[model samples]
Each structure stands twice: as C-alpha cells, then as structure tokens.
Target chain A: MATLELQGIRKSFGTTHVLHGIDLAVAEGEMIVIVGASGCGKSTLLRIVAGLETATEGRVIIAGADVTRLEPKDRDIAMVFQNYALYPHMSVFDNMAYGLKIRGLPKAEIRARVQQTADLLGIGQLLERKPRQLSGGQRQRVAMGRAIVREPKLFLFDEPLSNLDAKLRVQMRAEIKRLQRRLGVTSLFVTHDQVEAMTLGDRLVVMHEGRAEQVATPMEIWRAPANTYVAGFIGAPAMNFLAAELVEGGAAAKLKAGATIAFADGVHPGGEGAPLIVGIRPEHIQAGSGPGSLPLKVDLVEPLGAESLIHGALPSGETLTVRMSDCSPLAGSVLPVVLPPASLHVFDAEGRRIEAVRRRERTAAAGAVGA
Target chain B: MMHGPIDATRLAAAERAAMKAEAARRRTDIVTHAILILGVVLFALPIWIVLMGSTHDVGTIARGEVPLLPGPYAVQNYLTALGEGSARTTRVPVALMMVNSFIMALLITVGKIAISLTSAYAVVFFSFPGRMVAFWSIFITLMLPVEVRIFPTFKVVSDLGMINTYGGLIIPLIASATATLLFRQFFLTIPDELVEAAKIDGAGPLRFFKDVVLPLSVTNIAALFVILFVYGWNQYLWPLLVTTSGDVETIVIGIVRMIGSEADTDWNLVMATAVLALLPPVAVVILMQRWFVKGLVETEK
Candidate 1:
C-alpha cells in the first residue's frame, strides 16, 4: 500500500485544458474515487496517475517517490480497464499469469499465484477457457483477478463496471468494495457514476468542468454540500432551489412565492433584503400545513413501489420534486410542504455556500440564558 | 361459425397449389444440380486433358489430335520427366527444378510474412516522426507492380551480386505492401486497452508482439502464406531474368524450356511437368481453405 499525492496536476491537449490544477492527497490504503460528468477530466487525471498520459504540469508522488517521469510498470501500478481488456487469445490462466511471466517469475510460482487468484475470484473452473467463452460478469472477474494477482502497489480502475448490465454492475460493485477492503491497497477509481463513487470511495472527489469541486466523505457531501452544484448533482430527484430575499435582520428569508420561512436554529449570514438561494433536498421535505410551509400544486406522481416521487410546482411557478411514500396525491391538488430550516442550505449569488447566521443568534440566546 | 358444406372446388384448388409448389421446388433442385455439375466439369476438363496427354507418347499430342484416353506410356513419361527431364532442353532434372521452386516459394512466403508482421506491428503500435509518411510510402508500392519496376530492381539485385542466388529471387519479391496493409488493418482492430494492459503487465513492445499480437494473427498469416506461396511458385519473368544456369531453374520456367524453337517438343514430359506444377498449390488451398476464407472475411471488418 502507498499514499498517493497529486500536487497541482494540470493537463492540456493543444490548449484545450482538460484538468485545471487538481491537488489531492490520499492516505495509505484509502480508496479515492473521482466522480464527475463525462468530459470533466476525471479519466484524464486517472490516466496521468497511471503514467498512460503525461501531465502538462505537476508531480505524481506515490509512496513519497516523485514518479512523474516513470513508466506505468515502473510505478508498480495495475489497471483494470473499462472493457476488461483481457487478452482474447489467451486462456484465463494465461491472462492472469501474463504479468508474472513477463516479470520472469518461476513457472510453478506463476501457476500457484494464478490458481490462488482464480479461487479468490471464483473463476477457478474457467482457467482454461478463453475470454470469448466467458460471460460479461466472468470476464470482469478475470480482469480484476489479473490486477489482483500482480499485487501492485496501487490499483487504478477506469469505470470497470460501466460495461456490465445494471444488476451485474451492482454485484461487481459490492465485490470490488469487499476485495479492496480485504487487500487494503491504495486505489484510485474514476467514473461518471455518482452512486458508484458514493458507495466505493473512502472520500469522494466531486469534480466539475476541470476542477475538484469538493473532496469529502459521501455523507458529509450529501449533508453539507459545498456549493449549489454538489447539492443538485449528488442527490436523486435533485434538490430544489428557490430565489429569496433575506428579511427580518438576516433571521428569515422571504421566498419569492411570498412565504416567509425562518431558520430553525440560527440566523443566516446575510443582511436584510439580501438576495440568496435556498436549497432543500427532495427526501427532507415534510408534508403538512405549518407556519413555514410552501404550497405545492401537484402535477405528476411517479410510483416506485416503496416511495413515490411527486413532481409539482411551487406557488412561485418553480418546479419541485418530493420523495414521499408510495401513495399518489391527486393531480392539480395544492399540498402544503414544509422545508425544515435545519435541512435548508443557503448559497450566495455566485453559488458558493454562506454560513448560516448562527453567531448572532447563538450569542443573543446565550446572553439571555445567562441573565 | 356454422360450417358450410365442404367445397370440392376449394379442396381441389388447395391440392393443386401444393402440387405446383412441390413441382417448383423439384425444378429448382434440378436446376441447381445442373449448374453445379457444369461448374465441376468446366474445372475438371483441363486436368483430364493434361492427364491423358501426359500418358500418351509425344507423337500423338504433336499430331494435333488431342487424346481423350490415357495411353500405356504413363509410367515411362513420368519417370523420364522426374529423373532425366527432356533430352531436347537443358539437361537439368525436373525433380531438381521442383525442389528449387519449392524452396523459393517457401522462402518468399515466410520472408514476406515476417517482414510485413513486424513492419505492420511497428506502424500500428508506435508513434514516431514521419510515421504516416512511412506508411504511405509503403502503401504506394502497391500501385507499382514488380513488372513496372523490374529493370531497376534487377539492376539493384545484380549490383548486390545476388543474381543466381535465392536472395535475389526471394528478397525483391518479398517486400509486399498488400500483405503489410492487411496485417496493419488486422492490428488496428486490437483494442488500445490491450496495449495499456500489456504495458502495466511489464511487457515491452517486442514482448507484447511475440506473446499477444502474433498469436492473434495466426489465421491471417496462414492465409497470406497460401497466396504468397502460389504467387512465388508461378513466378516466370523474374526467375528467368535472374537465374541463367540450369542449376537454379524453377519448374514453371523449366516447363517452357522443354519446347525447343527448332526441334520437336517433348509434349509428354511437358504435360507431366504441368501436372507436377499444379499439385502443390491445389494441395495448399485445400488444406488451409478454412483459415483462408476466415482470414479474408474477418480482416475486411
């Protein structure tokens, strides 16, 4: 296992900058997943670390060795490609043994290692079969087995599960997590899937455009997203955003829909009449009429067996989605839904998060209690 | 629905339709067999004529009445052709020429495959300066057949003192852009991930070529071997230009030498040699037919 650090890594392909100075430090044996939309430089960053692509600027230091100029094999890293990339002409045994054979291992040791890995991957019976004879999930297992048998210092996966069907993807995803935990090898996995990132990474690096937007634990990112982008991108059915003006001396926000909603715990960090954006997750919205409840006109309902998604419009003519129990509300009915202040996230005009105005309220409450 | 009285006319019409369909199918089967038999006859007629001519004495064929049946001198004609050749031509044994032809064809086939495989591998896998220019230069050679550049090529061969040697016969003909292009096309279908995986597996370019690429190319190589072998064995012009002595005479050119300009040609021996020349290539095609067809079609994709 090794600690990997990327210091100011940047890349450009003829002035088309793909990665814009990404800096990250991964602890030993931690899985750092880089998740983003396509063309967001996630794969480019992984390739740079694998020594398949060169970085225009910065150092790739693994285990305290600056390997910016080293080859992939010299860096002691193994990669599982998106397509599995097994040697089609070779049997599973030879495919797993190829790396060791190239490293000039003895024949008996190579066979033993391959057998052991095949057993670990549950592909022991498939050792003599070629890649074309195996199903997709089996091929994926062999690909992983090929990487695991090498026992390299670091493992890099480039969307290895993307090619599998949805059900197999989940199975293989869990298998990869279990295997990585058992091996405890420092790994860097790049994918365009948010759920894969959330379930697999020790810390998720949510990237946008060409930069790392946030690097935090999945729960932390889900609970306290750093910006509007993370808040919208991380959750299913997405978080709802509303334009509002801070009123009552930064204590509450007057929504454009004419509902004045107060902070449940503290005041927001904005002056009166200051413009802001409020974010509320779909699952967090409570259904009932209350003091801070916003009126929703239900337009459509999607029943998903356990929970239904209610897509509707607010009084301000902005669309909102709510994850509620699997009971359909009548179309065109107005339902009052409460966006709890504790679950509210406030952002500035530039989409950056501004701290909830807690100091003023906390100080006043503490002073009153003391008196 | 209430069943109406059974209509005899409708039953008759249905039976007539089924009978007509059966007749049509039988007609098609007959037509197909007729065409196939005609094709088989068209191919086999020449071999039949050669066989009959080889068995007959020289006078019967030279008299311009082609024999339709084999004669009694089949053993004598074949023995003469194999052991002593014809007395009217250069006295080199036809057996020796057959050996020389076999050697040349084998060399050319093996040599072209080796050169093309490596060159195509380099062109497909590596990036260096003028890579496209080098590939285009090789591709352009396809337009210039050896017949177009024969003199200059022969001059170069003579300058290198390769005349009358196997190197002269084989080397100039071995630089085939078609084979190289075919192999290059095959190599391009190999996934780029395989290369990356090989690199991470600690296999360098040469090792990867040996362990992975070559194994995948077996069918293509076998197919090309069949084509190049036939091409090399049938070569008449270049071999005639290079080898002056009877020692290096190939069977194809040696067959022509059997017919003297001013003397009665050894028709029996010549026909026997023609039979010999046709055997090896036909055997090769029949043996490697499966791989040959597969390689041709798969490489197109």
Candidate 2:
C-alpha cells in the first residue's frame, strides 16, 4: 500500500496560482524527492503534505486516512528545514525531546529516545549545548536527531543540506540516506540541486512551472528526459539541443546544421519531414570520424585532469560540446565527432519526448545485454 | 659614489613634510576634544544645577542664584521628600508617590509588552480574517497619542469607575503602537522555517510562541522594557488629568505639585523629587545597556 498520496493538489494565493493540480503517491518506505527551481511550487506541495498549507482543491491521504484538513501537529510527520531551525534557546537534548514532551510522553521515554538518536547522529556530547553554540554541521545533526526522535509516520525535508558547505552537504546527504533507509520511514525531500536529487531520491519528481515535468528514477531520468526542461535541468554541463527534421521515412534525422544521423532501426512514428528537436548529452559524443560523423571547429578546450571538454561549433554555426579523455587538440582545428544512433534523444516541436523509436530500441538493446 | 654627499635637501624636505602632517593631526585632535567637551558640559549643566539645588535649603534655591556646590542639607531634603510630604502640596508622602509611580510604570511596561508580543505574534505567524486590518488598526494608534483623544479616554475610564485608581492611570496609556511596531518588525525577521520546524515538532501556536518566539525576543523585550518603563514613569499629563487624589498620583505629577503658586514654592524639594524620579529609569538603562543597544540596532535592521 502507498504510505502517502496527494490527489489533484492545487493551490493559489490570492488568484496567483502557485501550484497547478499535482498528483503523487509514495509506496511504504520509499524516498521521493521533489526537485525544481525556485518558485516552481515544490516547497508548497511539500508544505501541503505536511499539513502546513491547505491545498485549494485536492485530498491528502496519509496511511489510508484523509488528513487534508488536519493541523501540522496532528499530521504525524517530522520535517528538517534548510536552516535546521533548532530552537535557539533550547539545549540540543531538549530540542530533540521537545516533540515527545509535547506529545505527553513520559520523561524517561523522551530522554531515552533523545539519547539514542543523539548517539546515532554522533551528537551525544553536544546535547547540553544550545544551537547557537554549535557549528553548522552539528546544528544540522541535532535537527535530524529532533526529527528522528519523533518516530513519526512520514519525514519531510526542505532543502536540509542547502545551508552547509559543499563537503558537509555531501557528508550529511549520505548520513540522511543511511538514516532514512535504516528507519524505513516514508520520506519526501525537496531540493533544487540536481546532483543532490539524483543521488538522494529513490525516485525524482522533476518539477517545472508548477508542474511535474517527469517522475522516474535518476538513471531513467538521465537516460531519457521527458521534455526539454528536464533534459536541460538534470545534467551538469546540460544536454545540448539542436533543431532537426525527420527525413528518409523517419529512418534518420537531418540536422538544421546539415548533418544527417541514422536511427538504430528504420522505425519512424512521425510523418516524413516532421520538425523535431535532437537532444544529446555532452558525454555521449566521442572524438572520431565515423559513417554519420560531423566535423566540429574547436573553439575552446577545458582540461579537467582526467578528462577534457571540447567546446566547438558545427559547420552551420551551431555550438556543440564533447566530453573526451585528456588530449591536447590544437585550437581552430576541425575535429570529426560521431553521434551514435542509440545515444540521440528525439523530442517533438513542443519539447515533449517522442519515444516511438528510440525508447523501444534502447529497451531491446538493454534486454539483449542483460540476457 | 659614496651616496652622493648625503642628499641634505631631500632629507630636509621629507622632515618638513612629516612635521607639517604631525602639526595638522595635533590641531584636529585638539579641536575634536574641545567640541566633545563643550557638548558634554552643555547637556550636563542643567542636571548638575538641579543636583546641587536638591542638596541646598529652600531659601538658598529661592534666591534665584543657581547653586554651584552641594549644600549641607542633602540628607534632610531627601528624608523630608521621602518621609514627610512637601508642606505646600497635598501632604501625601513622596515615598507613596514613588511607590505609585513604580507600580504604574511596572504595570504599563509589562502590559504593553505582553499585549504587543501576542498581537505581533498573531500578525506575523498566523493568518486569519482581519489579520491585516487588526495590524493596521494597531499601527494607526501611533498617530493618536495619549495627548490626543485624551478626553474620550478619560471619560471611558470614568465610566468604568476606575478614576483615581492605578488602572485609570496605566490602562488608558498602555495601548501604545511603537512597542507593537517594534515587536512586529522583529518578529518578521524570525525565519519562517523556525515556525514550520516548530509545527513539525508537534508544537501548537502557543507552544511555538513560548518556546521559540519568546526566547528570541528576550533582548527585544529587555530593550523595550527600558524604553517603555521610562515612558511610563515619565507620564505627566494623563496622570494629572486622571488622578485627582494624592494617593494615586505619580512622582512626575507629584513633583509638579510640589511647587506652590508664586514665592512659596519649595524648589529644593522639587529637585529632590526629580532626582528620586530619575533613579529607576537610570538604573534600568544601566542594567540592561548591552541588550538595549543590541535590541535597538537589531530590531531596526
């Protein structure tokens, strides 16, 4: 059974619609991440689930019960905020035990729970110190301990690691994943960082303009983005897009830059000469001449130790970036690069994925490789 | 070339430049100190004269020559001011007036802070019908000070039969907007995440106020306490209009009454009452000076 469900959630603040209708479900103990840029309503959706916000039109069901109208305290959820939000005046121990005390748990039980969680987070010695005195990472641990001690039915995180330095963020990211897995609690984490979303979520909900652009595992999202926004947003050194038209009965696409690349199989879903978008990740292109290769005029080279990025323009003045192993290529030289048919992602003119040809071929190839 | 004859002209020119810079710095330092000292003396003169006058006999003060030195009668003047009431005024002891002032100030400061803190919390943290309307109504009170609309407020207090009571003196003046505005501004600076975090921790609105909001507001409360206490203690007009009886009279009103009409006025006793009145506010400011400065600067920010 799904542990949490949001059905047709819609929100508007004074006629300014912040969230369009959103629907989602989380299986028991699954970690779902809602990732989006700022103002995309990801945080608003999380707040609605936490019972901090009331959806304009929808039902929020937790543990098979409708809790859309309940207060946040009665929702049986724990949240860790980006700023940690540990009570400034309370000791670390008191901060962790605050929720339990409010729930009318006995003193002994609250103490034991807080101590156990504090020890787990390795903040046992800092229990007597106030939040103002601890380092940022320590405060973050205390915040997580506060949530963990509650033992609530659901966990919500709103960019909890965004405040920390990069190194600490990575460390805390692993700690949170490990803790969540061990606790086996259903969780929803919201973040704008694509790498964090990719590494942390069991399934990522990529949101754009108050809509969920796509929901899939990280590898699936990387391999096949649902739209132009998701394709540009999910990768570091994002995917490159080029205008193209399907030709030769959809067996191949002729780029506007005048390069024709063949599909893996002669399968065409659209009519001949249909306008399309060709999406290719930087890492997918290789530096070599082949049957369907295009010559690229190298403009700049970025050497990053083990690998180098070759930034260049095609013959028709369209820019392209190719990630390759470290090798010094002279500037202003024409390098022939190949685009394998299986590596190309084709989208319609409206930026929606057209999976008729490539998806089937990729899955079949995967099945063959697995067999 | 053995340093080219020691270059006496360049060395002399460098020394002359250094001497000129030194003289200019000395002149600026002298002028700065002179201006600061003048400002200090100008502000301190009235207080110094009052202090010296309070130590003298009534006859010496009545001569119209400002007393420049402490007299031999400092102890007797304060004793008579605190114990025996001034003869020309209604014979309620200054001690009783001091107590009344203290009580009124304490009540007003505490009442205003309590009211402002809760109202500001509601305005900033919760959303309800008329939230902004209520906030704007409170904010509008800043323009309508106690001096304005004084008659209506007094009439209301009289209708409630609270005339000559401490409530009449404090309650009508308790609903101030500056403190509420200060608190509201400070509360808005509290990150919304703290409230959300508290909610997720199973805290209700009241719990969040007490545990999170109140602690964060300590400096602000202390700071406002100093300012509001002085404001309450120094209230003269309202107390005079409301308290017809000497028993409920504040020290500020009592001091004004100490001066008799014409030549019979006891200036020494009036100055003594002034000194006593100055003590509580001065002590409050001194005690909470650190938090006061921090609160003032931070709340403004």
Candidate 3:
C-alpha cells in the first residue's frame, strides 16, 4: 500500500482541453471516489494516475517517487475498466494470472496467487470459463480478481459497475468495498453516481468541469458542503433552490405560485431586500402539516415502495417535492404543506451558503467577545 | 351462400380453376429447379474441365476433346510430362518445382504476416512523432499497383545482383500494403483496456502484443496466411521477369515454361507439367480453406 499524489494535472487532446488543473492525494489504504458528470475528466484523472494517459502538465508522485513520465508497466498500479476489460480469449484463471506472468513470476506462484484470488472472490468454479461465457456479475468479479492478483500498490477503477444491472450493481458495489478493505490497497474509483461515491469512498472528491469542488468525508460533504454546487449535488432528489429576499433578521421567501413564507435567524442578515436562493432537501418538506404550513397544490405522487414522493407547486409558482411514507387521500390533491424553519437553507446571490457561514462567524465573534 | 352450395354447376367451375392454379405452381417450381441446376453446372463446369484436361494428353485437349469424360491414357501423359531427362534447357522438375513453390509461398506468407503484425501494432499502439503520416504512407501504397512499379523493382533487384535468386522472387513482394492495413484495423478493434491491463502486469510492448493481440487474432492471421500464400504461389509476371532460369523459378513460372518454343512444341508434356504445377496451390487452398474463411470474416469485423 502506497500513497498517491497528483499535482496540477492537466491534459489536452489536440486542441480540446479535457482535464483542467486537478490536484488530489490518496493516502495508503484509503478509498477515494471521484464523482462528476460524464466528460468531467474524472476518468481521465484516474488514467493519469494509473499512468495510462500522460498529462500535458503535472507531476504524479507515488510512494515518494516521481512517476509522471513512467509507463504504466513501471507504475506498479492496476486498473479495472468500466467494461471489465477481461481478455476475451482467456479463461478466468488465465485472465487473472496474465499480469503475474507478464511480471515473470514463476508458474507455480502465479497459479497459487490466481487460485487464492479466485477463491477469495468465490469464482474458483469459473476459472476455466472465458469472459463471454460469464454473466455480467461473473465478468466483473474476474476483472477485480485480475487486479487484486497483482497485489499492486494502488488500484484504479473506472466506473466498474456502470455495466451491470441495478440489482447486480448494488451487490457488486458492496463486494468491491469489502474487497478493498480486505486488500487494504490505496484505490481511486471514478463514477458519475453520487450514491456510490457516498457509500464506497472514505473521502468524496466531487468534481465539476475538471475541477475538484470539494474533498471531504461523505458526512461532512452532506452536512456542510463548501458551496451550493456540492450542497445540491451530494444529496438525492437534489437540494431544491428557491428565490428569496432578506428581511427583519431572517429571509422572506416565496414559492413559484406566489405563496410567501418567513424564516427566523438562520440566514445571514445581508443588505435589505437583496434576493437570495433558498436550498431545501425533499425530506425536509413534510406532508400533512405540523406548524408554519404553507398551502400547496399536490400535482403527483410517486410511491417507491418504501417511501412516497409528492410533487407539488407552492402558491408562489415554485415547484417543490415532499417525501413522506403516508399514501394519504390528499395525494394528487391540492393541499397545504409546511416547511420547518430549521430545515430551510438560504443561499446568497452567488449560490453560497449564507446562514451556515453566519452561524460560524457568530460563534467565532462570540468566542472572541467572551475572551 | 346457401344457394351457391346447392349449385353443382358453380362447384364444377371452381374445381376446374383450382386444378388450373395447381398446374401453374407446379410449372413454376419446375422452371425454378431447372434454372438452379443449370446455374450449378455453369459454375462447376470450368473446374471439372480443367481437372480432366490436366490428366489427358495435350493432343486430345488441343483436338477439343470433351473434358468431363476422361479418355484412355491419362497415366501415360502424366508420367511423361513429370519425367526427367527432358530436352528443354529450362525444364523444371515437378518435384523441384513443388518444393520451390512451397518454400517461397511459406516464406512470403510468414514474412508478410510478421511485418504486418509488427507495423500494425506500432502504428496503432505506440505513439511517436509523425505516426499518422507514416500510417497513411503505408496505407497509400495499396492504391498504387505493383505493376506500375515493375520497372523500378526490376532495376532495384538487378542492381542488388539478386537476379535468378529466391531473394529476387520474395524480396519485392514481402511487405504487403493490404496485410499491414488489415492487421492495423484488427489491432484497433482491440480495446485499449487490454493493453492497459497488460501494462499493469508489467508487460512491455513485445510481451503484450504476443500474449494479448496475437493470440486473439489467430483467425485473421490464418486467413491472411492462406491468402498471401496463394499470392506468392501463383506469382507469374514478377517471377517471370526476375528469375530467368528454372533453378529458382516458382510454380506459375514453371507451368509457363512447359509451353515450349513453337518449333519444338510438346503439347502432351506441357499439359502434364501444367497439371502438376496447379496441384500445390489447389492443395493449399483445399487444406486451408477453413482458416481462410475464418480470417476473412474476422477481418471484416
């Protein structure tokens, strides 16, 4: 296990710049997931680290050695591709043993290592089968086995589960996490899915346009995102943004259909009448009213087995979603909904978290004033 | 409807129409089968004629004897043409020619495949300066026929003092534009991931190509071998110009030499020698047809 560091990484294909300057570090035995939309250079960054692609401008240091210009064979890093990349002509055993053979390992040792990895992955019976003969799950397992058999210092995976069915994807996801733990190898996994990043990665590096927007643990990113992008990106049903204005130490916000609501003291007291964006998660918008309920028209209800999602419009004409478990008669009917003040988030004109900072600044000022 | 069932005259008329339609369909089927049989015979007739003529006396062939039906004295003509102690100065023995053709064809086949594999692998995988230009240069050769370059090739071969040698026969045609491009295309179809995986295993270029790309391209290589083998075996014009003597002659040149001067015409011997010359190529095609088809289909992909 070795630490991997990428400094000021940049790549360009002909005239098109694909990867802007990207800097990241992976500690030994740490799982880091680089999450971004398609073509955001997440995979490219991983390839650069894996030494598959040469960065036009950057330095890659692995285990205290500069390997920026080294070939992939010299990098001591293994990569599992999105498509599994199992050699179609080879059986599972041979596929797993190919790397070892290339390294000039003894036949007996290669066999032992391959057998051990196969047994670990529970693919011993499939050792003689070609990639085409295996199901999607089996192929994925063989691909992982191929990487793990090498016992490389670092592992790179490029959307390794995007090819599997949803059910198999979830199953393989758990298996990959468990395997990484068992191997304790430094790994960098690239994906566009947020849930996979949050679940698999010890630290999540959320990327937007070839830039790392935030790098933090999953919980830190969830609780306190650095910016509105991270805040809106990390959670499901994506954090909703509503237009609002500051008034009377809080903010006066209105939904799309012109229904107004007031918040108390969570947001920064900025210049009066300055419009800002309000962020709220779907779960925070409760149904069937408690206190401070706003009237909304229920448009549609989607029941996803465990919970029900109600899509509705506020009186201020702002579209909103409320996630609740109850399948009540009011679904698909016009009804009043309440959003608790504590759950409401206020963003400045630049889409930056205002209230969260205000609380931090106030705490610091109070500490200073008390001292 | 009920009234029609009660009418016997109308039923009789309907029965006559049904019978007439049946006769028409039967006539059409007969015509179709006849045409198909005619087509098969038209295609197979030439091969049948050639095989039969190869075994007959040249006089009988010159006299326009029917070839599908073999005449007497097939063995006499074959033995005489294939026999030694001939009067022609450039008479190539059947055994010698067979060996020569086999060796030449094998060399050309293996050499072309080896060069194509290496060049294609380089062009597709290794990134260096002017790679695209180099690839296109090799690719553009396919558009230029070797016939156009015959004079220069003759001069080059002659200058190298390779005349009357196997070098003269094999050197000029060793590297093929078609094979190189074919292998390049095949190599491109390999996903970069395989190479990446091999690299991670610490496999360099030589090992990766041998272990990954080459084995996967067996069908293509097999097909190209047969095709290029035929190309080398059936060479006529180049070998004719290059190898003036029978000592280093190929199969096609050997077959042509069987046609003696007009004054010393030996039709029987010529046909017999020609027949022997054709056998090697026919054998190669027949034996390797399976691999040839596999290579072609795989290349198309």
Candidate 4:
C-alpha cells in the first residue's frame, strides 16, 4: 500500500479550464471517491493522477515519489475505465497477464498471479473466454482482475460501475469495496453517483464546478456540509433550503415560511437579521404537533415502499419537503410538521455553512473528523 | 361466425388456402433455383471451355472444332506447356511464371497490409503536426487510381534502376489507399478508453500495436490479403510497362504472350497458363471467405 498526494493540480484545454486547482493527500490503503455531476472535472483529476493527462501546474506524488512527468506506463498505477476497456481480442487470462508481461514478470509468476486474482474476483472459470463472450458484470470483474494482478502502487477507477445495470451496479459496488479492503491498496475513484460515493469511499471529495466543495467522510459530509452545494449534492431528493434570517441573538432563525426554528447545538456567529439559508434534510423533518410544529399544506405524497416523501408548502407559501416513515396523508390537507433544532444546517448569504460556536464544550465535536 | 355443427366447410377452405400458399411458395422456389442455375452455368461455361480447350491440339482449336470432352493428350500437353518437355521452346516456364506471380502477390498483400495498418494507426492515434494533412494526403490518393498515375510511377521506377526487378513489380502497388481507408475506418470505431487502458498497462505504442491492434485486425488483414493478392496477381499493364526482361514475368503476362499476333498462336499453351493462373486467387478467396464476411459484417466484438 502507498500514499498519494496531488498538489494544486490544474487542467485546461486551450482557453477552457476543466480543473481549476485540486489538492488532496490520500493515506495508505485509503479509498477516496471524487463525486460530482457531469463535466465536473472529477474524471479529469483521476486521469491526471493516472498520468493519462498532464496536470498543467501540479505535482502527482505516489509513494512519496513524483510521477507528474512520467508516462502512464511508468507511473505504476492501474486504472479501471468506465467501459471496462478490456482488450476485445484477448482472453480473460491474457488480459490480466498483459501488464505483468509488459513489466517482465516471470511467466510462472504471472500465471499464478492471474489465477489468484481471477479466483479472487470470482471469474476463475472465465479465463479462456474473450471479453465479448462475457456478460457486462463478468467483464467488469476481468477489468478489476487486470488491475489487481499488476499490484501497482495505486488504483484508479473512473466510474467503473456506471455501465452495469442498477442491480449489478449495487452488487459490484460492494464487491469493489470488499476487494479494496482485502487488498488494502490506496485507490482514487471518480463517480457522478452520490450513492456510490457515500457507500464506497473512506472520504468523499464532493466537487462542484471544477472545485472541491467539501472533502470529508460520507457521514460527516451528510451531517455537516461545508456549503449549500455539498449539502444538496450528498443527499437524495436533496436537502431542502429555506430562506431565513438570524433572529433571537443568533440562537434562532426566522424563516420566510413564518416559522422560527432555534439552534439546539449552539448559537451561530452572526449579527441580527443577517440573511441565512436554513437547510434541513427531508428525512430529518418530522410530521408532528409539538410546540415548535408548523402547518404544512400537503401537495403530494410520494410513497417509496417503506417510507414516503411529503411535499408541501408552509403557511407563508414557502415550499418544504418532509420525508417520514409510514407517512400517509391525514384526513386534513394541512399536516403539522417540525424542523428539528439539531438537524438544521445554517448557511450564510454566500451559501457557506456556518458552524455554530459552543462556548462550554471543550471537546469541539463540531470540528470535521476524518474517519 | 360458426353457424353450423363444426364449421368444417370454412376449415376446409382455410386448409385449401394454406395448400394454395404452399403451392405458390414452391413455384417461387422453382423460379429462384432456375435463376441460380442460369447464373452458375453463365459463369462456369467459359471456364469449362477453357479447361477442355487446353487439352486439345492447336490445329483442332484453330479450325474451331474445339472438343468439349476430355482428350487423351492432357498429360502430354500439360508437360509441354509446363516446360518439362522442352527447355528451349519457352523463355519462361509456366512453373517459374507461377512462382513469380505468387511472390509478387504475397509481397504486395503483406506489404500493403503492414503499411496500411501502421499508417492508419498513426493517423488515428497520434497527434503530431500536420497529422490531418498527412491523412488527407493519403486519402486523396484514392482519387488517383493506378492507371491515372502509371506514367509518373513508371518514370520514378525507371529512374531508380528498378525497371526489371521484383521491387519494381510489388513496391509501387503496395501502398494502397483503399486498404488504408478500410483500416482507418476500422480503427476509428475502437474506443479511446482501450488506448488509455493499454497505456496504463505499461504498453508502449509498438507493444500495444503488436499485442492489441494486430490481433484485433486479423479478420481485416485476412479480408485485405485476398483483395490485394488478386490485385497483384492480375497486373498486366503495369508489369508490361515496367519489365523489358523475361525473368520478372508474371503469370498474367506469360499467358498473354503465349498467343502470337500472327497465325502461330499457341491457344492450348495459352489456355493452360490461364487455367494455372486462376488457381492461386481461387485458393486465397476460399481460404479467407469466413474472415472476409465477418470483417465486412460484424465490426465490433
């Protein structure tokens, strides 16, 4: 296993800059997933690390040695492309053995290594089949086996599972995670899927518009996002943002929906009547009749088998989405709901998260922790 | 609509309709087979006549009483035409001409495939300066067929002291734009990720070419070999224009020369050489038919 450090990597094509500047340090055996929307430069960053694309300004260091100027073949990295990129004419065994042959490994050793990797990937019987003869999932396994047989310093995956069917994608996601854990090789995975990022990575680098909006563990990113983009990008059905302002000495915010919700952790550091974007995940919002409950006029209820999403507007006509378990529409169109104090994420006018200041808690649990 | 006990009358009518449809299909099959038989006969009759004419005497053919049945002089005539009977009668034997044609055709086929594969690879994969210009230059040669550029080409070959050499016969015809274009089209459909993956696998450009590109191009090479071999084997004008000596004579030219302009034309020898010349191309086509169809039809794995 080896550490990888990317220093201020920037990429541009002529006048159009794809990646502004990205800096990341990955520890040994860690899995870092760079997740973003389409054209967000995540794949470009992975390619830069793989030495397929040159970073215009930055250094790519693997195992504490600079590889920025090296060719992809010399970089000691293996990549699994989105399309699996197996040699179509080669048998599965030959595909896995190609890199080892290129590296001049002993013939016996290459054979043994390929056999072991194929067994590991559960594709032992498929060694003689051509890529076109295999199913998509089997081909994906062969691609993975090819990289594993090389045992390079680092592994790069560029949306390797996106081409699989939904069920197969979920299955392979777990397989990849298990294999990464078993091998303990440092890996950088680029994906546009938030679910894959959340489930796979040791740390998720949530990117937006050529920038890393936030880099933290998945739960940390979930519980506390650095900005509105990260908060919205990490969660499904998206975290709902309501326009609000600091009222009651920064301890509470008055929403444009005519509900004043207080902060339970600590008071935010802001002046009076400062504009804020209060983000609360739909799953965190409860339909209730408590003291802080506010009226929600139910517009639509989307039932998702075990749970449901209650989409509606508040009293002052501000829209809010509430996800709750066993949530069916009641007799009345108006359903009382409460945005819990602990779950409210406060952002400033510029859409950056405002970490609440706790005066007495010396442990500083609010600090971002890397798991 | 069944208004009776079992609707048997309507069932019989339907059965009769089906029988009528079957009869119609049988008639269509007969017509189709008739056309196919006509095509087979149209293509086979001339070759059969040539085969029968090769066994006859020159007087028998000259008097236009060419026999359609097997003749007794088959072995004698073949031996005489093959130059095993008399060494002084022919300047080049049929065996030597065939060997020359085979060498020219094989060289042209292999050389064309190698040049075309590499050229197409470079055009598709590399990004050097004037890359497209180089590609367009090769592509533009598709407009200039061999007949159009024969004079300049012959002049170049003559100036290079290659007028009567095998290199003169093969090299000029080796750089084929059609084969290159076909290869280029094939290379374009190869995904970019495959190249990148090969790069990551520590494969240099040439290694990738040998291990990946060459293997994938098997069917394509097989298809082009048949085309280019026949093309080289059938060269009469260019070979005639370039070669003044009899040592570099190809089978096509050897067959043409067997017939004299005056009345002393050896029709049997000509027919014999013509029959011999047809064997190699037929063998190549039959050998490569599977790959040729696959290469043309299904491109991707």
lDDT of 1 by residue, B1-301 (tens): 2334356667888999999999999999999999999999999999999989999998888888788898999999989999998876567788999999999998999999999999999899999999999899999999987899999999999999999988888899888899999999999999999999999998999999999898889888988988999998999999999998788889988988887763478899999999988988888888888776775554331
Off by over 4 Å in 3: A14-16, A250-269, A288-292, A327-333, A355-371, B1-29, B54-68, B85-90, B260-264, B292-301
> What DockQ values do the models have?
0.57, 0.57, 0.57, 0.67
Report the C-alpha lDDT of model 3 over A1-371, residue by residue, as the tens digit. Answer: 99989899999999889888888888999999999899888988998898888999999999989999999888888889988888887888999988887778999999999999999999999998878888999999999999898898899999999999999999999999998998899999999999999999999999988788889999988877777898888898888777777665554665444445676555466777778787788888765564457676788878888888788777677888777766543655776666766777777788776753367788898899999
Q: By the DockQ metric, which is better: model 3 or model 4?
A: 4
Candidate 3: lDDT of A151?
90
CA shift of B95, model 3, Å: 2.3
The model with the greatest lDDT is 1
Best candidate (score: TM-score): 1
Give one digit per residue, the lDDT tens place, for model 1 in A185-209: 9999999888999999999999998
User: What TM-score does model 2 achieve against the real structure?
Assistant: 0.91
Which lDDT tens digits does candidate 2 get at residues B23-120?
Answer: 99999999999999999999999999989999999899787778989999999999999998788666778999999999999999999999899889
Question: TM-score: which is higher, 2 or 3?
Answer: 2
Question: What is the Å distance of residue A360 in model 1 from its true position?
Answer: 8.0
TM-score of chain B of 4: 0.90
Model 4: which residue pairs collide? none
Output the worst ten-in-a-row residue range by lDDT, candidate 4 chain A. A362-371
